[model samples]
Target: MSMREINFDGIVGPSHNYAGLSPGNLAATRNAGHVSHPRAAALQGLEKMRANLRLGLAQGVFLPQPRPDHAWLDRLHQRYDTASPHLKAQALSASPMWAANAATVSPAADTADGKCHLTVANLMTMPHRSHEWPDTLRQLRLAFASGAFAVHGPVPAPFGDEGAANHMRFAAEHGRAGVEVFVYGERGGPFPARQHREASEAVARAHRLDPARTLFVQQAEVAIAAGAFHNDVVAVANERVLFAHELAFEHRDAFYADLRRLMPEVEIVEVPDARVSLADAVSSYLFNAQLATLPDGGMALILPGEARANERVWTWLQELVAGNGPIRRLEVVDVRESMANGGGPACLRLRVVADPATVDPRFLVDEAKLDRIAEIVTAHWPEAIEPGAIGDPALIAQVEQARAELLRALDLVELLDS
Candidate 1:
């Protein structure tokens, strides 16, 4: 079987927020609502993505755990041999740190298959928001150019000025073939007065790539201006693009109606208004389900939003389950940290190539039988161990001990095939 590139938005550790409290002026004030503002949302987002990836694992629709976004790969991709002594030393230190401290690597448990795949992205980090690309891109390209991963250029539009323009130019100049550039309408502020055509033409000139083929959208706008563009998918262009909030009932209907009018023949999916928490959205969309392949055998629902928030994804899955068409299962990986910092699962994981080798044969679940499976998985949690309460050395030892214990518990889980 050929190794297929899996597109899963990897789960991010609460690094910016969950890593540890910051000491700078940006740190949260005393008695603040959260330990950190952006960090809090990022942690919540990470939790949701974890839930999604976990669900994918449980349902057998996903490969084993995803690759981390840290160090091992950085060493492989960096050219320390060509660097000056200072740069070489930096690479040397950085390489090991990436391996030790960074969390990116292929899954130990993932067996090769025609469909086995995985992907992960940095939590709460957008180039547009930080206006730190080129530099960020250099680091990312060094860290993640290996593993045949499809990389999405850093989204740096949330920052004011022509960040998006700069990002597009950068991608056009140096981006690999699969780089996707998704634009938002107005989160940091209102959309620039310049029209999409003007922006597209400018980016094309800067990057040297065809502007016609670049993926563009009106993200985060109050009123959807994209109804006119007969482009790809049109989702709920709201602030938080997840199930916790849905499109207004009237707006939702209108959005769909407009979509049909503009592109009657185009495949469309509408996001639903399910009030699932951010955590639940991440878990269900990323972890618990397999990516569903379209009948044409070309992947279509490859989006950068919540599974529940993209009506197209939900509809595609429903159609398959409803016997409406021919379908192949693809894994769905969520990578967003939360609505606060930016990004959804798609924003995180970039697909390198569609690997048929990464698909799990055991992917299946009866919603009716889900509760029973959860009960069995839950029973493995013993009340006897508390690593947080132990000494550092003892805690490390306990973790090793508990890992063995958990493996033993898996012996009782029928859902997990041996």
Candidate 2:
């Protein structure tokens, strides 16, 4: 079977808004109370997917969860109201649109039983994200329904689990068995560490990964406090290269040493702390990029528009690509709507290494499908969304109807249920 990594990007929902729910997310906090362009956001995301498909890469799409998500409120025997700040915030969360946090994936090549593994994140750390896993699990299982995959639920909470945002895998090639790196964190400062060490180990064991091929690294508490709530905010990995901030981990040097021992051919491409401080890295989301292996054996950095706009980040990227680096080019995309909520190109996707033929055909993407999805977004999605307007019956009805239209466009009628 042919093998390649499929990037399943979340289709941005019509309820996109800036509620500033994530504590350490600088963009969300900085852009709080701002108006959002739901149609623009969805169209931009679709364009990104189309770009990847044109590159001969395996591109897929994940439908967004219904917004004004009153599921949790219904479970709690409560109704939507501004009785408390948290109550109001939960009803307006659009976090499920960032699919990276949905699950941690282990390629079939890396697992012991020759079956891929997927574990839906608990996401128990933030109020806005707490309700995402159950919905996410349903979608994942339906998409990867073949016996070739084994899907697991999150480790019961009180222990936070932020999926691939805190996970990275490295290998000699995209199709080979690789080393899985699970980054966990500790509570040290104002920001609550979202990924627990126990949760990392639990997922690794559940995936039946080889002990020798799995590793657990602790995220630096300082990074978490500096708005890097997720390890991905400071680090990202491709086939054999790691682009990370110097201070991303608790014991950075030791972690790298262990990684070298496990995978001797691995290359470390670090952004020096002196060049870009942790705060700037978090703010610019320099590390939150998609380092994709292009068809011609060269790598390209798929960056959000913000990275090129940041003086320090863009200057460094230009020099990096100009030199004899593996990253051959930069493809900047406009995911500003998602960027305003503290996620980037990397944040919008869940990567899976598998044979495309084995996955459900409905999840696969093509130019015709992309055009149809875009048509639906342009025709049905809300033009703009204000945080306060989320409580309006018209806005809720419009959002729900837009999501339904998208599902029908993609043949994902199963997700229309509560």
Candidate 3:
């Protein structure tokens, strides 16, 4: 029953391309219709995992969902060959690679049933992401099949749930009872607020989280309008530390008071707007980082390369690390491809606190496994994917075959049928 935090990153798919599907994500929209390098993207993700493993953290991976979801296309009464551009883009979307939007997880320590409960996100706000739940659920169930876990389906539609991207948990340690914070949104000027308050409440109840320990906070509308579409885009939490931008929440002071009441040991690391503006935070993905507790009881911020490039953000981070701060280390990774598509280090992972033994072995990985996965990516994944290449028969064949090869390599072929 030794519990630890395991990050399950979604492997960047062979169909990884930028069609500008997400409206509020500035990076995705800015780089829309640009050519994508699927092979390089997947390799970057794998190298990130390897870096984590080297840091003595347990790492896991979720396979890319089947592309050209023919069944979904058929349901829409449209064939890939004859469908409209918009419809075709939706069908071939690789948005699921951002695993933070995969589910909302409540560890066994916080749930009434003493089982880690994960509810799949409905993602109803965006047309391109709305259909991801079924496939996500399949992977969740298979990976967390042990009795120590309970995987639930998505919250009903009309109530958008974007999963862990909008959630944060703070505790003294990984195995202890913790306070879970669910961040929801009401309004964004032009962009749709993705995570609804109703959806957060539903997930809280379904996970059987103690109402006393669960807090619902509103995301700042201004931050959303500035391209912080999800809460994680402006904030991230690890153990007892909350590393966030000052404009992350609607009622920042009230939320801080309530969080302190729930967990007295909580540390709030708020970055002011003067230091790094909300626009800079979103564009550089400074807050969209993986704040992880190290094996030696220290903390580290696994940031994307963009964070290091921004002068303001980088200077603030350097000062924080140089001083006697909780986050002692800074590790910058090159996930430029994912960053271009609006996913940083935090966006690419789903954080689950559980005993490693409880999760399916097939999902967990070591350095050797990552190396094998990289081989498949180098051999099968497409080197470059143009926007118009999504619907091409040749590209589709290669995409499907690449995923099949990874599944076979990992001995997780059951997912092919799923």
Candidate 4:
């Protein structure tokens, strides 16, 4: 079986709204209370998948998690009507649409058992996202129940794992054995540091990776303080190339030296601070772009439109493409709604290296499947959701029904019980 990287993007849920629940995520806070267009958001995500398909990339999708999580409210002993506004908002959060935080995946080549391993993240730091792992695990199990895969539950709480957002994998090729880098945070000044060091170690162990090939590095406090809540906001890695802002790690030189030692063929593409400051990098999500290996053996940076809007970012990108670099293509996509909510192209996807035939067919997509999903979104998803309308019984009903329609359309009714 040919093993290749398949990017599984999360479908934006009907509950997509701007509540500004994440403290360190600058964009989320800045866009709080703004009216959100769920229909538009989901469509944009689908369009991104379609573009990937056009590029000869394998694309899969994880459906939106059930919203207004009544199970969570029940644990709190409160109904939606009686719960405080804060609790209501948390229960209705659609943050799971960012699948990068869904799990930390170790491909078959990197694990001892020769099976792809996945560990769901316990987003324990943020109240709004802390309850996401259970549903995420359900989806993981259903999609990868083959003997070629092993899915583990989240690292116990207090470790605060944020999954792939803080993880980077470097390999000569997708199916080859590679080095895994886990970036964790210890400090962020006024904002809370989300990914904990212990959590990174725990995930590495759970995946049964060789400690020699696994590296743990601390995130630069300055980057985190500047709203780089996750390392992906400042750096991204694909195969041998490491594209990042210069200040992405606390010990940049040492990390680079270590990476080079482990993988002699590694290529480091550092964006200097003078060229694009940390603030601009975080805001533009320059490093959050998907650095994918194209079928022709070249690379492409699938960037959000914000990167093109930033003069410095766009200029640097044009120069990079014009040069003799591994990254030869720049594919710009519009995921503005997700960008406003603190997620970019990378955040919207979970990268899994496996034989496509091993995954559940329901999770994979082609042009026709996307058309069916888009039709459901247009017909049942709410056109707009006001910040104040999250808890209204009418809106809640609509959100639930919209997800149900998607499940039925995909023949994934089993998820309705999830």
Cα RMSD (angstroms) for every candidate in the order listed:
14.3, 1.4, 0.7, 0.6
lDDT tens readout by residue for model 4, 1-418:
9998999999999999999999999999999999999999999999999999999999999999999998888888989988988898899999999999999999999999999999999999998899899999999999999999999999997889999999999999999999999999999979989999999999999999999999999999999999999999999999999999999999999999999999999999999999999988998999999999999999999999999999998999999999988889999999999999999999999999999999999999999999999999999999999989987999999999999999999999999997
Give the runs in model 1 whose Cα sits over 4 Å from its true position.
1-14, 18-32, 35-135, 143-208, 211-217, 223-266, 271-343, 354-418
Model 2 lDDT tens row, 1-418: 8888899999998888887888878788889889988899889888888878877778988888977677888877777754354665676677887888989999988889999999999999887889888889998998999998999998897888999999999999978989999999986488788899999999999999999989999999889888898999999999999989998999998999999999999989888888888877887788888889988988988888888888988888888999887787888888888888888989999999988888998988899989998899999988998767867779888988988988887778988994
Question: Which clashing pairs does model 3 show?
Answer: none
Top-lDDT candidate index: 4
Which parts of model 2 have CA positions greater than 4 angstroms off? 81-86
State the local distance difference test value for candidate 2: 0.87
Superposed Cα RMSD, model 1: 14.3
TM-score preference between candidates 1 and 2, better one: 2
What TM value does model 1 have? 0.35
Q: Report lDDT per candidate.
A: 0.28, 0.87, 0.94, 0.95
Q: TM-score per candidate, in order? A: 0.35, 0.97, 0.99, 0.99
Model 2: how far is 366 from its true place, Å? Answer: 1.2
lDDT of candidate 1 over 1-418, digit per residue (tens): 3333333332221112212111110111121122222223323333433443343322211111111221432544644334343332222110110110111222211212211112211212211122222223333343344443322342223222222211111111111232223333332122232223334333333333333434444433322231201111122111111111233122344544443443343333333334333233332342222232232333323333356565544564555445532222333433332322223333333232333333322222233333433343233222222212222344334333333333333332331221
At residue 158, candidate 4 shows an lDDT of: 87
Backbone clash numbers for all candidates listed: 49, 0, 0, 0
Model 4 per-residue lDDT at 286: 93
**Model 4: ten consecutive residues of lowest lDDT:** 69-78
